[model samples]
Target: MEPHIAFEDISKIYSNHVTTVAVEGVNFQIMPGEFISLVGRSGAGKSTLLKLLIAEERPTQGRVFFEGRDIATLDGSQEISSLRRKIGTVFQDFKLLSNKTVFENVAFAMEVAGKNDEEIAEDVPQVLELVGLSDKINNFPHELSGGEKQRVSIARALVHRPGVLVADEPTGNLDPANTFEIIRLLLKINEIGTTVVLATHNKEVINTLDRRVVSLDKGRLVKDDPRGTFIL
Candidate 1:
């Protein structure tokens, strides 16, 4: 089977007052239906790699391919929109609308994607249920616990029924119990066939996952191990 995503000699360099190489000469492939942990420290290029994959930042050199298409070449707004519909992203900070309720927050994503009311009405509730937030649909982000807020974030990400889920430091703000809950949710998402690329620095989370691990250090690919542990 072909790789679901591939990074070929990827490098991203940022220039301003100072020059910073976020990533350099990185190469890896994510197979379909696989869960891979991207492990690294701060400034280790994990986030830069993700940005390249999503086309948020074009690589300074090399290519990032999603399902065999170079994402860097997706320059049109329509193309990027279509690509986003296929990849769901969850961030450490729950980027929910402060004034919107849980249901509305999830529904907003569909709305932005040009989903009609009927589609949003049907899909929002179903995704909320999938994330175990059925009863809290009316709660605001301020009213929910840290875990509940993150669940809502996950729910929003899944509402698109995306083929790939990219979660960056998803459990960064949660306590141990909530962290495990989030990890379990991610694993469950993976079990159902979504390609999950989880970029996290949590050692315990990495060790416990025991899945494919791609480690980076100082802007370079350090290791790619199947059933890997946290070894940076």
Candidate 2:
């Protein structure tokens, strides 16, 4: 069977007054419905690798493949946008538009992708309910709690039914209870068949996941195992 995602000998380097290598020669494969976590201390290239996967950063040396197509070699702007539609992304800061209501925040994603108003009208409310934010639809980002903000962000990401959701330190700013809640949401998304790639340092959360764990250190892949736990 073909893997859902794979990174082949990927590397990324940043050059300036001081040269830095973010990730080097890292490779891995993810099967369908598998939940994976990438763990490391700061500057371990976890985010760098995610950037490469989505084509935000070109690999300094190698390439990545999604659904068997080489992402680095993909042609056509519209096609690239199509690839992104299948992958959801959530970040630590809950990148919600501060001025918009939760409903508009989620619904606008569909609008940008050219989804019809009728489709957006049906989808946005369903997604907000999925994220447990139905009552808060009228709330602005500033009015919601941190956890609520993240859920709104997630609702937006899932509005198009992304095949995969990559989260980078999504719980970084949350309290312990909120952290668990967000992680639980990610797990729930995985249970629904959206491949989840979470980059985190919370050992307890990783231990609770009981899924594949990929460890990285200074741009190199150090460990990979089924039912893996977080360890550096």
Residue 109 error, candidate 2, Å: 2.1
For residues 190-225, what per-residue lDDT tens digits would candidate 1 score against the true structure? 999999999999999999998999999999999999
Could you tell me how far off, in angstroms, the CA of residue 91 lies in candidate 2 after the best superposition? 0.7
* Tens-digit lDDT track of model 2 for 114-194: 899899889999998888989998999999998999899888888888888989898888899989999888989999999
Task: Note the residue pairs that clash in candidate 2.
Answer: none
Off by over 4 Å in 1: none
Candidate 1 lDDT (Cα, 0 to 1) = 0.92
**Lowest-scoring 10 consecutive residues by lDDT in candidate 1?**
47-56
**Predicted candidate 1, C-alpha RMSD:** 1.2
RMSD of each: 1.2, 1.3
Candidate 2's error at 113, in angstroms? 2.8
